[model samples]
Target: MDKMQRMEQLVEQLNQYNYHYYTLDQPLVSDKEYDLLYDELTALEAETGITLPDSPTGRVGGELLQGFKPHRHLAPLWSLDKAQNEEQLINWNNRVLRLIADYNSKNPDTPLPDPTYVVELKFDGLTLNLTYTDGKLVQASTRGNGVIGEGILAQVKTIKSVPLTIPFTAGTIEVQGEGIMNLSVLAKYNETAAEPLKNARNAAAGALRNLNPRTTAERKLNAYFYNVGYSDGIRFSSHQEMVAFLKENRFKVNPHVTYHDSFQEVIDVLHTIVDKRSSLDYLIDGAVIKITDMRTREVLGYTDKFPRWAVAFKFEAEETTTVLESVTWNVGRTGKITPLARVEPVELAGVTVQNCTLNNVGDIERKNLKFALGTRVFIRRSNDVIPEILGKVTEEQDGGEIVYPVNCPACGFPLEQRGAHLFCNNRLDCKPQIVSRITHFASRDAMDIETFSEKTAEQLHDELNVREPAELYTLTFEQLIKLERFGEKKANNLLKAIEESKGRDLASFLYALGIPNTGKSTTKVLADHFRDLDKIMNATVEELTELPDIGGIVAESIVSFFADPFMQAGIHKMLSLGVEAKPPQQAAPVTDSFFSGKTVVLTGTLHQLGRDEATARLEALGAKVTGSVSKKTDLVIAGEKAGSKLAKAQELGIPVIEDEDELIKLLNGQNE
Candidate 1:
């Protein structure tokens, strides 16, 4: 067969397989066989240079777009009003009933009866609006504001569960759904990803907004149609009927939707979902309760931003009250001192939490957090990670106001306040600070020294008198064998890991050094700009500040750190110890770029790029990026969200660019 004919055959076969696997819950072919077919299709498409829009190979990805185009939605996507507790939910139900009663009174001939509710899980993901015409998918967009959205048709086409076409041949139909990455999918991605995704919601949102459709396809995103936003040639009497129609038309609808006659039943469904939340393969922050009767919804109408017929019942945060025992100060890698609260052991989200962070002295003062020994305090486990102290629950005070330490907890050096944080000036002498720095150097995200732990660092510091990172290379395996829990095999492995870390890239080495205000992204920027550690060491503050996202304070911090005699000696010692920091592979610079040599600041949340990604993109286009707005800033890109930097740009009269498309146009010298 010809390449075109083979491609058509492959597309047909693959689409059938996907439909069976994702929609039918059955598979006719093994995973290995499917992969082989997919590979064959990919090769054939490449050979022929012909790709069909509905082809299963589209799930692999497509070319990157310069920017997303604005799409005016056919119908308004209203945000639902939220209820945090049972009382609030009941109040909302009462309002719905009252509105329906008023409507019935007006139309005496056709009196409305009691209203029922349809409760569905509120999936924690990005809202997507899909438009279908003549049973064929035409467009997909995100919920940007309410009336207009960013077009994401290419990314949406890559999702296996989202039907490209349906059996129904109805005229223009718009369906609303959520674009989500399953928790299992996110976990698998995070296993090999350099930067782990925080949660399923963020993973899904990030994938959909990426400029590359291939990234979204690689994420294996899913969508569940819930509501019919607009229909030209179709009609439904109730929400339940609409959901049924969606399912019958081969669209993926949520399975947890239920029709409830009473408010108590809706509450029961919420409880059930909450109980099953840990076991589900997706994340749900709340349950949506909407009037089931279509007539009731029309009568109730909508408020400014939310529909009066629907309310979102948010699940209560996992929190409990515990007794505050005492507070302790801990020193970190950068010699920054943090206050920690030693709370009475309490079980939160199935884990025993004994300690929680109090942030700093400013946080304590802002929260009016006073802790007497044995004082009851509220603690919450947010996002199932760290347990944070909410506030003091009991009024009874047994101890005096908690005091901020004037000296470092480990080295007894005088503490210096830098903004909201307290820092220990003794960078070389503090034991805790040294241990933390060493531990961070060996962390997986930094140098990736396998088997290195905080306890190991502490033991090495206390026993072997290891004062600096270079000293670790001089330690013998025999010496490690002398430490507690260190056997012959373990000591050998640790030594091997230390030896391996010496060959890490310059970015990792820079981050391992624990330079002040230098995170992974900043280290990468520095490495990409300077290429070598020696150049970075000799760079002036002006040169450093000229890089993207590097502000005056961060540049000053970097210069101050590199100029320190102790730091210079330590770096030389490491280099002498066979630590080979490789320079980043170079790329040709972009010439005649409009953004070249311009200082730009991005404020609020950009739909297409995260803060780090935006900084990198702007830097790639030859723009100098900074975090804050200033009179010196040549341009400010303000996004959907509101932030202080946006306000400052207006106050300073700095020219502000709205949305990514406008920025792209400006960069292409197409701005009018």
Candidate 2:
């Protein structure tokens, strides 16, 4: 046979060998034997000065690209709603039941069947959408914004398990999978690299996104296909069928793909996966739960953000260790000093974390971090909050001591010990404290000043000699116009906002005052109960504590705040400058409403009602709206994409009202 014909034969045989070895993890030929054939194919391709598109030799690294071109996906990639715990998973199942039942009710003649589910690992890696026409791989792209993605076909071709050609030569189709660096591969690569990679996920993602395909090839990435996003001449009745098609096409399918007729069985599999996660060779932050029935998925349909038929169960907070380099103290508007620990930058949960909250000096002492400077410490990040230093790696203090400050770092004022916290009493003179106070007073919850920001407050403080909330009312348009970035329109707008804030009701004014230990809820309660600011100011600690949700600490805070001469003078000055602090007019109690006397919680996105509007309506009807699910909750109004709280409510067996129409009817007194 000629070289070209021989190359063709060798390519087909080698591709089959590759499929068995990489995709199937069952090698049909020894490494030495495969290399001989590969060498011959390479030599023949060089001799002919040509390479076939489907040749096994195409897997080699190629020349660098100038830039990535945009490729719009044939079908939009959808994001799944997430569940953090089993309670949330249960809630998702409940939502599925309701949607299926509602659809079945509408179409009695062609009712949908009870839903089965498929669970697969949510791999921590870059998402790849590969397009094929006539069973030949034609395009590959990232999941950028879901609709359009950066084309990386050259880079994707480097993945050994990815099939360049499939047996089915039908119309065009798009297959979705995750491009991941196996943990073992990452470790092996790091052993000899000049610059070691911090995590497998970033290594895979960076390699795939690199301009040079040769860099991607060196990563030795693997891919696991689990979805057929678009197909012109094919369709699947279930997720199991789609995965089977992927495997049949020689696409690498994860072994953990599980199907169950029962949701309980699905949960069991998830628990097992979590337990076996550390033993796996790749990184997975969570597991995805998808309904198996295509008809059921169609019935459930999509929210603007995610499909109602699927949800991701995320694992707990990720933890990592880094050196505690130093700690910096910051003073807040409340005069409390907080310790901010600066640590050696470490990759955790897909981001670099260099700073962690130490909370206070007492937290440092309790965690034995008082002498943790320059020592390794455990840090944890959860729910997207700032990372926190959990504790030192060991009890032994092998590093220098974390010296406590005797004076405020922001203003150098003498500090006072207040239980577990240290306080700086120079509230009026301290630059940080005064700037923060002014900023808080003009915040959205407080005065609702338009275009007002912390930087604006700082400028006003430094350039215009403005300090305290009352001083904001005294500013002139002429004064503001002279400041940097302040034009005539901006100055007038600021003045207008300041003037409009004078008519704000008592609750907002109270919250703007920045009373220690009191939040917006407490201020609202104080306003609603007392009606007048003077009454609240004169209220004894006993009287303040009598109200619901007001504990001793809150009552003491309110009493101590109003008792201060400086605070009293500030309130008086604001009133003198036309600040109304208007009391709300009394209305009859909502004693005979459907939601009256009930404790309710709201979760998820409501298409018909904004969360704030829903909360206002619930409060108007005498419902005590809360932020969490608990035994005390009488009802839970779950909207689209409801997650953990919805699950917690279901777990606690609380009554749930998911129908927007029903909620609107009840809210309108039609149901009552």
RMSD of each: 21.0, 22.5
Model 2 error, position 77 (Å): 40
What tens-digit string does per-residue lDDT give for candidate 1 at 1-672? Answer: 888888888887888888777765556798999999999998887887888767887676779989999999999999989998889999998898888788888999987769888999898899999999998889999999989999999999888888887777859999999999976687577556654454577679999999999889988898888988999988899988998899887777766688989989988888866754544467677889998888778878888889999999887545678887888998888888888899889877668889987777766654446545567777766444467675666444555578889988888898999876899989777898889888988898688899999998999998988888878888898899999888999999999999999998898899898888877768877987888899999999999888877889889989999999989998999899989888876556666677788888876567866665777677777787766666578888876553556545653456787667777676557756
Q: TM-score, each model?
A: 0.50, 0.54
Which residue pairs in candidate 1 collide?
A: 61-214, 549-625
For each candidate, the alpha-carbon lDDT, in order, equals: 0.81, 0.87
Model 2 bad stretches (over 4 Å): 1-317, 588-593, 601-610, 626-632, 636-672
Task: Identify the leading candidate in terms of TM-score.
Answer: 2
Clashing pairs in 2: none
